[model samples]
Target: MPIPDEAAASAAHSVRHLFSRRSLHVPGTRLGAIALPAPIGRRHHWHYWWQAHFLDCLLDEHLRDPAGNALSEARKLARGIWLRNGGRWLNSYYDDMAWLALTLQRLDAMEGRRRPRRRVRVLGDALRSAHTDELGGGIFWNTTRDYKNTATTAPAALFFARAGDFGRAQELLDWLRTRVHDPATGLYLDGVKADGSAGGVVDRRVYTYNQGTVLGALVAVGGRENLEHAADLVDAVSRSTADDDGALPLGSSGDGGLFAGILGRYLALAVSTPGIGARAAATGRSLLATTAERLWTGRMQAGPGVFLFPPRQEGPVSLSSQLQAWTMLEAEQACR
Candidate 1:
């Protein structure tokens, strides 16, 4: 399962190219923004959530080349995010903030930098503030408070668990279990309306990142029960998410492009988790290896490590898509 050195070199070149073209140094702010590359047609611009994934990619690149500037670039991006929000990491979207907190926590663990403690605390408190008893207790997607989604709640739980706030993490876990989880499918549903009067209609669509963040949270706060739940989730996604050729489908370029890579990362973690059954671990590794091979050999075209999201051909390159592929490649190597 060692990634070909050519693949690793290609990934490094793609990541560095992305930083050069997409990253912005906001004058007078510590934030180095990774803005969306220019459009060929209709496209999203400057999504705040993407920077967190970018930092995660930088972490992978740093692991590949410790002597490289990945750490310095990550620090600048972290500070830029903080400074851009007017000295606060909190934003209208709690989910967006939670992603940053999670990334900062990992960056801090890896680099032991000075600012993450304060940043994580501030962002963590903000995430907790969004949770309410409205829909039987889960976090809303944004400050508007209209929806309680796994996208927000699961990552919030992960941040708390990773930051050692297990009590808060369990609160999120409890809410997810009783509310949005579809026991029949062994997967969490998409979301529910936050309005109590709406009777909490849960959207049943299964997104890979939602499943992933939940799995990651459970892994952080480990126990036999949590591991069992993680295994069930892996079973469900492994059976359901692949396309005809057995390549995992990341639905589209925007958020969908990152979904499977997110799952791949946690799946790798599942493989390494002690006491998880050997069968589950083997399954996880197989999924990672297979998906990485497909993406590396099939979807990548033109530029170094540039991946076209499945069926789409014409548009600016999706930085998220490329980052996710790099994550898959990195996870494949690390887990092996």
Candidate 2:
């Protein structure tokens, strides 16, 4: 069964009400708490990439309801990110910068505004510069430039494709195919070390978000070949990740919490995109619907108009977990 529109909206509303906080001194800036019922008197670590995903979720809400305050709220959150990141949009992590760049591009396109274009351009340039011949050609994960992985490269490919730099995007994808694509599992490995004692060694760990970004990048840079690859990836994810009832396993807290939801977001894209095989699309849709139903069923009420979502059917509540559930619910709604 498809998730109801009201349920998705309620999840969004609860997330905003429970996690959002405004900076008293900064006036216009706002940031999300790292956890719910935020721990008092402790210094909250600012998670750059997590905030980027949060911004993307806000844009998802805006697209769903044009008349709502989501766009304005997104603007404030973007501003907050800038302020928190020392007034610069470019971050050290190529993946972090790519995520922000993608969200900024979406914000500009949706609002018909040019304000984020400069930031997007800077981020794009940084990502391009990070892509070198190291590890047989892929973007480095961060400034240390010691590792190249699907987590960084795939999103960077999608960003370039979205920005009309298809040559660069395809180059990145080609490198991924050569270096990280696992033939047996049809899933991507984690990354490769650049200069350690274990240099040139493949991590070989499969991650849900890595598959999600690569799946998204392939669809974004669509042709007959890329579409076929995307379909195969969809099939691979369903085979390897889904349970008997098609629900994905629970991701861990912190960054892991967002993993399955990220995959669900791209799975929705595969379901909606043209030219993907029907079986692959059906597989994507079934996983999303099943997981969303599980999330809705497992939600715990926190207060009037606020609810907490675990990363899976059961776990401790954190901002990342709640955001993950919201991301999946929104993806399910989009598929509907």
Candidate 3:
């Protein structure tokens, strides 16, 4: 499924417009609570939605190789994910490994390629190993042997859903709602302790990404008739996102480039909900269009057909964000 030289160049040139040089610091020092200098800043670390967002988008455009397979690149990206070779798969579902799971299912459906049968079993084993009743029932960050982070848990739930493991998905969603969701804003707090309460925990912030994640999870579960306390979860997201101009910080700002990737995926889910009505969908499209335009630099104008990223706020647009933007845009088009 490798793109042909010409088509690949077109894809490369179009996508390259978003790349900019930036320094990602690897930590040599550790602060009290936060992992300063952070382990892996930007190398080989996949985005929150490479497949679900951009690569998929390119496939929709018939640009991901003339053969129409986005799954190929997805597998290629999986190789770079944290736990591919004897280690754990990244650390959370929100970004690296979780993103892989989200697209893997659809890609499998589309192209029929899997992680081999043995590989699938291995992932399944890893999933069971990672689950615990610790936080009343949330999956840990790594494969059960290590720590847990709410950041990774939500995506893991989505991954389970993608693979048709609905039962496990349900358990994770229940734990998230009970443990991290704050009823007031429909927004989720960061990681919770093993006991499942925000109280006495040093971490307590309603990030846009978490809200998007929890919202997407809620939407997924809400489809079932008898799911306990489903309506309220949707209501929370609606209330939190509603407001005056710029009422809340948009997770995917137009010019954020890479950061926009998170917003792109969340907005796609928010807009796709069946009963949400047309108004919600319109607003979502408007937001995505704005972000795309802002992130567009004059990269394509260069001679040999080169795409460059604008060194805006976050330096240059990230490759992942471009894919996310493209993927979300494709989803929007299909809905219409």
Top candidate, metric lDDT: 2
User: Which candidate number maximizes TM-score?
Assistant: 2
Query: Over the stretch 203-291, how does candidate 2's per-residue lDDT look in tens digits?
Result: 88999999999999999999999999999999899899888988887665788888988998888987799999889988898888899
Q: What's the CA RMSD of model 2 in angstroms? A: 2.0
Over 4 Å off, model 2: 114-116, 196-199, 312-316
> TM-score for all predictions?
0.88, 0.95, 0.64
Cand. 3 Cα-lDDT: 0.48
TM-score, candidate 1, is: 0.88
RMSD of 1: 3.3
- Residue-level lDDT tens digits of model 1 in 193-232: 7445746777888788888889888888888888888888
lDDT of 3 by residue, 1-336 (tens): 211224333434355333311122212210110111223433444333342344344345543345643445444433333232234443433244554455444455565565434444455556666677664566666543334556667777766766667788778887776777676675677765544453324257656556556656655755644122333443454456544432223233232333444545566666667765466566665554444443342123434564433332243334543444344444334334
Model 3 RMSD, rounded to 1 decimal: 8.5
Name every residue pair that clashes in candidate 3.
Answer: 16-307, 17-307, 17-308, 53-327, 54-323, 83-88, 93-152, 130-144, 254-291
